[model samples]
Target: MIAIPVETDNGTPMSTKLFGNAKFFALVEPKSKDYTIIPNEGCGNGIQTANYLLEQGASSALYGFLGDGPFHVMVRGGMNVYWLGKETMPLDQAIDTALSETLVHVTTENASLYLDPGTAAGACECGCSHD
Candidate 1:
């Protein structure tokens, strides 16, 4: 399953809140269009969220913006990561687009090219704060 962090279970457009702050994660079965929303127990920590998704059977994740910590954790855990197109893409449309394989495939080497440590003021980038 591919996990897409979202604002809610009924969210149309996926969440743009960045990986660590998403309120929920929708685990979608790409071909079946079947999905389930799970509340993010790790809403303030990117690494925790990434690990949580992995434990929930998500082999991949579609994300717009994320921090280095989560990006590393996701890829290190053997999960495929894709850069989500359009921050406002609808949940259903995103699922379809993901299967097409057009989205930029993210890997450890290219993670810095697309990710930020954090965008908040005074945010730490060393991944030392565990964000």
Candidate 2:
């Protein structure tokens, strides 16, 4: 199942931001084109949110943006992260894009939100600046 953060339970459209502080999550099954909207009881805690998604049988998450800590937690839990870009479209369209293999796969290296300042500056492996 793929989890998509949405503003409402009706699933008309996806949230503009990531799952952070979201009130609901739409757990979608691509094959059947069915989905369940669930409340996010984790509050704003990233780790807790990740655990919640796992408990709901989510194999992947589609979002507009995600922070570093949450991204790592989701990745460690064996969940694929996909970026929906800057467009805010209907939930069904997003699912279609994902199923058609046109969404951008998010990874540590390419996820600019998670990049450390030292790492981006070509600092040592220890993440310490020599300057």
Candidate 3:
């Protein structure tokens, strides 16, 4: 499995179409310390972002957190959430945190709104809150 770590300020994944400030670190197995960087768009639509990653060959995503809406977006795009986060950390460390920490369960009727990993409070900025 290939591991892709994207450092998002709001923890909101962005569409692959636009170019922005988020940091994307991708790791392919069997090669130690061989993570590659992909340019990111700050924010756009959550589902688009997941689809972009899927097209890039990622089967799963490790993120800080996701609300009901964006979570479903990822799922529909064929990506699974491995972990959650409160803020952006080092790509490698964030991956470790997700692997070591417990994650919250998110669900929604609308697939687009279900997997919204924007933030705890669904805010892209600092004041976001969640379970």
* TM-scores of the models, in the order given: 0.86, 0.78, 0.53
1-131: candidate 1 lDDT, tens digit per residue = 99988887763646554777788888898778898888988888788888899899899998877877788788878999988854656677778888888988888778767775447663534355443
Candidate 1 has a TM-score of: 0.86
Write down the lDDT of every candidate, Cα atoms only: 0.78, 0.71, 0.45
Candidate 3 at residue 43, lDDT? 39
Top model number, TM-score: 1
Q: State the TM-score for model 3.
A: 0.53
Report clash pairs, candidate 2: none
Better of 1 and 3 by lDDT: 1
Which stretches of candidate 1 lie above 4 Å from their native place? 11-13, 121-131
Candidate with better TM-score, 1 vs 3: 1
Give the best candidate by lDDT.
Answer: 1
- Give a tens-digit lDDT track for model 2, residues 15-122: 546465667888899899788888888746555776789888899987775556666767878999888775567778877887988887888778775323122343
Superior by lDDT: candidate 2 or candidate 3:
2
Model 3 misplacement above 4 A? 1-33, 98-131
Tally clashing residue pairs in candidate 1: 0
Q: Residue 10's C-alpha lDDT in candidate 3?
A: 37
